[model samples]
Target: MKFISWNVNGLRACLKKGFLDFYQEQKPDFCCLQETKMEQGQADIDLGEGMLEYWNSAEKKGYSGTAVFTPHQPLSVRYGMGKEEHDHEGRLITLEYEKFYLVCCYTPNSQNELKRLDYRMEWEDALREYLMELDKTKPVIYCGDLNVAHREIDLKNPKTNRMNAGFTDQEREKMTTLLSSGFTDTFRFLYPDLEGVYSWWSYRFSARKNNAGWRIDYFIISDRLQNAIKRAEILTQVEGSDHCPVLLELDI
Candidate 1:
């Protein structure tokens, strides 16, 4: 099975920039999106027949949101983490299939100067707890923009970017805890020493042209599925928003 995740920044803008073409060409079994920046009724995504679409829009209008497109019909679908504090932004959507759960998440950014670090920490704790709870039932296939560069190799200039929002010690430690708890960072697990491959780039300063970017987006699966994972990649060539898509091929 093939799974792809991307943070589009804005779905509306992305569609104009070949979203449908990419969707049709790749034809993944499941396509998860983050930062949709759209509200209900605004998205009329028809990915042709046999595709099921699910959206969790933020109440705050065009701010933060998530969506999922899958050919496989899930047994159950859930939105958010079931906590009002964390549910407001529509950052999470969980789908339960026969074999496992598919979680699409858009993690919050810490923002410039670490403005939202405290709230982001709470989110990390809550999201990890939620994933752990689901792991108690079955394995998980979680994907999307995790918003953190867990290690030095994840970003081009890690030394200069250290202590920044996504590379802060606190955020990186949270990701460490998550992976140590039973999840595997699929891309890094497959290519631990690979360098300069990134999924997201800043539009400013012609970052993409220089290939300066961060591998913040991910497909993190339960460690039990490590052997089942076939391939993982950062599609740097594909473009729309500042971020590109990450693909995962799994035997399961």
Candidate 2:
């Protein structure tokens, strides 16, 4: 199966920038989007024939949201973590397939000055627990913009970005804790030591032109699915948002 994740930044803007063109070209079995920034019926997105769409929009207007488009229907679908605090942002959606569960999430950012670091920490712990509980039932394919650069190699200016929102020690360690528990960061698992590969670039300072970016987006699978990975990729050339799509191919 082919699964892809991208943080569109804003789906409405991406549509004007050739979102459908790329979607048609890839034709992935599943396409997951983060930071959709709009409510249902706000966009002219038509997956057209043979596909089903699921959306979880934030209660706030034009804010954080997520969606999934898949040709294969899932046995069950869940919106949010079933918690009032986290559910308000529409940051997570889970689709339970026959073989595994696919979760799309837009983890809350710590924000400038780490103003929201406390909330983000709570989210990290809760989300990790949520994922592990799902893993107990079946292997999982968790993908999205997790908002943390797990290692020094994950970002270009690691030294300067050390205390930044996404690269802060506290945030990075949460990712380490999650991975150590039972998940596999698919891209790193497949291409250990691959450098200068990134999924997100800031709009400021010609970041993408200089390849100064971070690999915060990911496709993390249950450790049990390591043998099933056929390919894991960061589609850097595809453009529509600050983040390029990350792809995963599984034998299962």
Candidate 3:
């Protein structure tokens, strides 16, 4: 099965930039999106027949949100981690299939001045606990903008970005903690030493032109699903948003 994840920045803007054409061309079995930045009924998007579309929109308009599009119907679907406070932003959506659970997440960013670092850390803890609980029932396929460059190799200039939101030590450590709990970073599993490949780039400074970006978006699966990962890819060339698509082909 082919699975893909992307942080579209804004679904409305992405669609205007040929998102539908790109979606049709790729034809993934399942797709997850983060940072939709839209509210319920704000815009209507026709995904066509045979595709199931599910969205969790934030209460705050044009803010954090996530969505999932799948060819197969899930046995069950859930929004958020069952926490009232965290559920409001619509940052997570979980779909349970026969074999596994697919979790689409848009992790909270620490912000430019690290003002939200404390809250981001809290989110990490809660998210870790949620994933662990789900894993006990079945293998999990979690993907989307994790908002952290786990290692130096994940960003073009890690040294200079150390203090930045996504590359900060606190954020990186949280990712470490997540992976330590029996989850495999799929891209790293396939390309252990690959460099300069990134999924998200800044809109400022012509970052994409210079290929200066961060591999913050990812497809992370439970340890048990590691052997099922046929191929993991970063589709840096295909773009409608600031971030490009990351693909994972699994033999499920």
lDDT, candidate 3, 217-239, per-residue tens:
99999999998999999999988
The collision pairs in model 2 are none
The most accurate candidate by TM-score is: 2
Q: Which one wins by lDDT: 1 or 3? A: 1
Model 3: lDDT to the true structure = 0.92
lDDT of 1 by residue, 174-248 (tens): 999999999999999989999999998898999999999999999999999999999999999999999999999
Ranking by lDDT: 2, 1, 3
Model 1 lDDT-worst window of ten: 38-47
Q: lDDT of each model, Cα atoms only?
A: 0.94, 0.95, 0.92
Q: What TM-score fits each model?
A: 0.98, 0.99, 0.97
What shift in Å separates residue 106 of candidate 1 from its native position after superposition? 0.3
RMSD from true fold, candidate 3: 1.0
The better-scoring model by TM-score among 1 and 2 is 2
Model 1 per-residue lDDT at 178: 100
Q: What pairs collide in candidate 1?
A: none
Over 4 Å off in model 2, which ranges? none
> Candidate 2 residues 1-252, lDDT tens each?
999999999999999999999999999999999999998788788777988999999899889999999999899999999778789998999999999999999999999999999999999999999999999999999999999999999999999989999999999999999999999999999888999999999999999999999999999999999999999999999999999999999999
